[model samples]
Target: MSSVVDSTCEIREAQLALQRDGEELEHVEFTINSLYAEIEVIPKGNCLLQEKRHAVQSRIFTNSARISPVRSLPTEILQRIFKVCLPDDRYVTPDIRSVPLLLCQICRRWREVAEASSELWSSIAVYDLSDKGSYTAMVTRWLVASHHRPLAVSLSCRDAIIFHEFPLAPVLRWWSHTQHFITFVYTATISGLLD
Candidate 1:
């Protein structure tokens, strides 16, 4: 009779354990289903979040630029600052890599300030006018930017042929017509001519 009772108790324990395992399995399946549902909605939600973030970033950038100290500077002060940036060589060439031209390329406001500041354009050096048309146009533009200020010009040539071909008549005519005081310097280095 004791053996029969022991067998009955063991059978009852096994049934209870099987019921608990079934309940645990159902809970795990429900959790997996919930996760799948969330994954389906995540992409659209993520896109909306990204768009909001971008808008906020753009507003911050615009507001920061608007309140910048550089933008607050007066035109006269800015022009003075620009003058200090000019090269010490006294005569500037129209190279985009250099000060005056580089300043103009920065922004519209700087371009306006640099172009309007006659002092920055007062002295220019023209090197080897092999590109005659472009050089003339550039020289003309530089002179115009000088406005009524006194001008200093330097012309340098390495080859005699190119020097002779340089279109100087138009430049001379323009200078004669201007009321501003002008100083012109010409330098030529031919292999044998100087010796």
Candidate 2:
């Protein structure tokens, strides 16, 4: 009878230990689940933080540009700066890659300043009169942009006949009325004749 009682007590103790271990396992599983939820949120939170940082940086850059020295320069001083940037060539070509046209392309304010500065458009060289139609229109626009400022026009052709064929109506009209000093340079290469 005493052996039976001892067996029963041992069995009860084993059951209690198992119950306690099961409760501890449940607590560990709960903790793991909570950690997984926090991990999932971290990436989303980090993305939001990054977006706000980018926005702030962009604003700082914009504000800094607004206070730049070049932006604050007077229009007259800016025009002088544009003049200084003009090409050393005898006459300005309508090439968009060069200074005066390049200056106009920078921004609206710069375009306004460059276009208004008549001196920037006062000189032009047309290297090809083969496309007389386009050249005439281009020359007329260039002269008009000069706002009656004295013009230095350079025309180059392979044949003198091309020069005669070029409609000089626009140039003549400007020359007839304006008292401003005008310089005209004509160049022709009559291959064998020059040699």
Candidate 3:
């Protein structure tokens, strides 16, 4: 009789696990649908927007895998995986700690996946220096981003909403580093963006 009771409890646990998995599948389906839907919104004569989407999709996959063709992975990733790696910049680097923390916190497996993906950690996204100065703290993050691999930077503007802060040295270095890694630089100036 005790054995029969144990079997029933096991069956109930199995059902609960199955239900949770079904919910997870539903969430994944929604994400994919949204990505494709974004493509549908692409209008005519906007080749640049289309190209950006394609490139982003490609990066999403490449970074997730963690293995990059570079002689080394990016510095932001290194800073994340190897905490004591760069002692010089540790004191003032807000972006360095936050980028990986946010991505890894998305979920347990994603944290594991992001951790494994050195490429995902490679490139750093710089926030511009704003008039309000929310991004003053992110200087180290930019440095962390360009640390291991040559920098692939995106510069927003001289505007208040300076979305990125690319290191000048790495920019020059990456230009001479490799032809295979194409860096993209984007800008949305404050006057144009806010006005």
Candidate 4:
């Protein structure tokens, strides 16, 4: 019967498909086994490479023992060098690139030296004291840096009209306790400025 023939063809097609699937499965299994073998060897090679890198780093570190010529100097000599960096006869503006502050930024060693040198921070100048809050903070820092030493402060009144506008009471109170306080105020005329 034609039905029986159709069934026979269907059975043959199914068997061919099963054989194809079995071949594909075997190919997939081979690929997976190959990847597993590669993975097993990878850790050994990776560990060896890591060890080689660490050894090279150690050698580099040993060779770089004398990286900076300045580091060889004694602390006393270094402190003198830091002192020479400051302005000899001028006020240090609140600038980022100036001597004492810049020295602090150079490295930890320089920072310690600059910080320990109280004379470097003893001189302070106020070009404009309009901002009382900022002036307070700056004065506080200068006092701390002076380490109970005398302070040489210069106050410049840019505008006589705005002189009363500034907070002078707090400034007076802060500098009162200083042992040796030197204050210089530059003005064209002090006639009615206080009024």
Candidate 5:
């Protein structure tokens, strides 16, 4: 084999490589410090931004809350409002003048509250006790509307009224819980109403 001699070139090449590596190390150190400083500032800046965002959101929520007049009302006041919407008489139907029916029509919440309320349906007035289908249905509905609460019934009939023949079965069924309060006496037909 022939002897090779490249030691001198090899040494020079090694020294040049060392010099470049030293410069690269210094540049890397500088870049690392710059990045560290930026990293520290970014979190603080983000924290301030977040604080501003939350403050603005809070102000917007407060302003929105101030706009609702009914939302701020207490539960007691809301209950009173519901009570005022009830009719003076106890028995009611879907007539426009019927308070319970009207209140139920206004909203879902009103319907729930009205239907469950015993006081609102405690007073019922029966204009007639005839065996006619509609009148019997109305009387039955009024009794059911009371919902186990004590009832005040007003019974009156214009013509000759008879107890056994009249639609008094449902009323008599609830007689234990009912009190006949008002009686409109006619000429000759409503004797069995109070009984």
Candidate 6:
């Protein structure tokens, strides 16, 4: 489970890195092309053209050399990077997995990193999911790797009152012992409100 979470985290970082770098590359290319075109038509003694060209060239070189700072990130920095990968919300309907929690999508190394870093994936938020079996499994992995650290969980109204999510019963039973750690959201029902 740890390995699964780790890989998922790294893969997520890779994908975001690719998207960000790709955009920067495109912007740089466009600026360079526009400058080069203007330089061709500039008059012989144009100081503006010379300065613009120099600036563009400098930026091009700087950006080219820097594919991404993450490429050479230290271990502490990398862990920090993974921390943001975890989204505050967990149950987003179709996407069961959180952004930072999906490092397996990036590559093998990231997957390993995420798995090894239990804290990265220990946070959980309950919403509409009916089954807790899978969650229990995930919790176990997190519990073991979390080194006795308490896990963070957000309790939402839907999951607060034992919504008949069949899977939840087993999980509740399993965690009947550690119920205090998780946050459960609750709202007043019509009957409760009336009363």
**What is the alpha-carbon lDDT of model 6 when measured against the actual structure?**
0.58
Q: Considering only N, C-alpha and C atoms within 3 Å, which residue pairs clash in candidate 4?
A: none
Tell me each candidate's RMSD, in Å, in order: 6.5, 8.1, 26.0, 8.0, 15.7, 29.4
lDDT string for model 2 (1-195, tens) is 999999999999999999999999999999999999999999999999999999999999889878888898999999999999998887987766776777877878998899899779878887765665855556555666676788787766666566556556644564464445478876766674554
Which has the greatest lDDT?
Answer: 1
lDDT of 1 by residue, 1-195 (tens): 999999999999999998999999999999999999999999989999999999999999889888889998999999999999988886888776776777878778889999998889889898856675866666667777777888888878777776666656754665674466577887776774555
Alpha carbon lDDT at 80, candidate 1? 96
Worst 10 residues of 1 by lDDT: 170-179
Give model 4's TM-score versus the native structure. Answer: 0.53
Candidate 1: C-alpha lDDT: 0.81
lDDT of each: 0.81, 0.78, 0.53, 0.72, 0.63, 0.58
- For each candidate in turn, the TM-score is 0.60, 0.55, 0.27, 0.53, 0.42, 0.40
Error of 1 at 32 (Å): 21
Predicted structure 5: clash tally? 1
Tell me the deviation in Å of residue 164 in model 6: 4.5
> How does residue 176 of candidate 5 score in lDDT?
44
CA displacement after TM-score superposition, residue 16 of candidate 4 (Å): 40
lDDT tens digits, residue span 1-195, model 4:
999999999999999999999999999999999999999999999999999999999989766755867888888898788788777666665544776667777777788877788768867776665666765555566666677776677766567654655556655665666657654444423556666
Q: Write the residue-wise lDDT of candidate 6 on 1-195 in tens digits.
A: 999999999999999999999999999999999999888877765877898899999999778757765556666666777877665554221132654446645655566676666557456554444445775455554444444445555534343234433344565665554544545333322343333
Distance (Å) between predicted and true CA of 110, model 1? 1.6
Best by TM-score: 1
What residue runs in model 6 are displaced by over 4 Å at the alpha carbon? 1-72, 88-97, 131-148, 157-170, 176-195
TM-score (C-alpha) between model 2 and the true structure: 0.55
